[model samples]
Target chain A: DTAVSQTPKYLVTQMGNDKSIKCEQNLGHDTMYWYKQDSKKFLKIMFSYNNKELIINETVPNRFSPKSPDKAHLNLHINSLELGDSAVYFCASSQRSAAEAFFGQGTRLTVV
Target chain B: QQPVQSPQAVILREGEDAVINCSSSKALYSVHWYRQKHGEAPVFLMILLKGGEQKGHEKISASFNEKKQQSSLYLTASQLSYSGTYFCGTVRQAGTALIFGKGTTLSVSS
Candidate 1:
């Protein structure tokens, strides 16, 4: 079984549209995070939540939103997507703030 | 600021040794190392806390220098299966989220 899984591994959309990617982890971790990987393979942290509470939110655009209904799920929603939003979005989790992180397969989002 | 990873890529023959370096401009409290193969999720290798402890798994080892906000990963007697991209994640004590480096690509040859 996959330790962490994300839906719609591939997300293709147009500019000015809205989209959402779902992520779930069964590793029983309390902390979850969202990251965006640019074309140059530079990974940037967008948000992090612990036990459904927002812990850290990077300097991301307001168009991006993260929701954690519970400890096992953390989903990302993007509104009015732009061409710059076309990148790989990764969902990750760890036992706590300083533990080793477990990453999901990643969602490749394409915006035209 | 983003952490800097040196030797963007490396090619090592089996049984060869290599070192990958990661440094940050800001102070750091901990550093994490992970390996990601192409088309695969990154797998955690080791973590170096604030202390000067060196952790290792098999022939792979890592050291963290809190003073200089730097860390080094040593791959000894590298094997073909060791081919992958290594990433270093750093977190300052005042911050909870980790800032990752671009990554180091390692190719182990026969």
Candidate 2:
């Protein structure tokens, strides 16, 4: 079974369009995170949810919102996407905070 | 804060070895190593706790220096399959998020 999975592995959308990426993990983990990898391959943490509670929220734009419906699912919604939003988004889950994380296949978002 | 990685990229031939370093400004509780291939998810390699312990995984090993808040990943007898981008993730304290470095690209040729 896939430990962590993200839907819409590849997403190409136009500017000002809104989209959402769904993520789910079956690793029975309590902590989940969303990371963004830019063209430079710099992985930056965007948000984190522990047991469905927000724990870490980076300085991301207001247009980007993360919703965790349960401990197993965390989805990212982007509003009025910009060119800068084009990158690979990865969903990860860990047994606990600061522990080793298991990553998903990643969703590549392309904005034109 | 994000850790700084040295030697942004490296090229090696089969049987050669290389080392990548990661340094953090704040005191670290632990350091994790991951390797990612082109268009693939990052795979966890190993983790080094704050005790300055060294951990090994097959031909790959890592050392952590608690005093300096630094960690180094060592790859020995590199194989073509070892070619990937190495990333170092650090945790400042318990129950905190893991911050990652920019990653070092390692290209191993036959």
Q: Write the per-residue lDDT of candidate 1 for residues A1-112, one digit (tens) a residue.
A: 8777898899999999999999999999988999998787778899988888898888899999998888899999999999999999999998886788889999999999
Candidate 1 versus truth, CA RMSD in Å, comes to 1.5
Candidate of highest DockQ = 2
Predicted candidate 2 versus true structure: per-residue lDDT over B22-104, tens digit per residue? 99999999999999999999999998889999999999999999999999999999999999999999988888888899999
- What is the per-residue lDDT of model 2 for residues A1-112, given as tens digits with 9 covering 90 to 100? 9999999999999999999999999999999999999999999999988888888888999999999988899999999999999999999999986678999999999999
Interface RMSD in angstroms for candidate 1: 1.7
Q: Candidate 2's chain A scores what TM-score?
A: 0.98
What TM-score results for chain B in every one of the models? 0.95, 0.99
Candidate No. with top lDDT = 2
lDDT of 1 at A76: 98
- Each candidate's DockQ score against the native complex? 0.67, 0.82
DockQ, candidate 2, vs. native dimer: 0.82
After superposing candidate 1 on the true structure, give the runs of residues whose Cα lies further than 4 Å from its correct spot: none
Report per-prediction Cα RMSD to one decimal. 1.5, 0.7
Q: Which stretches of candidate 2 lie over 4 Å from their true place?
A: none
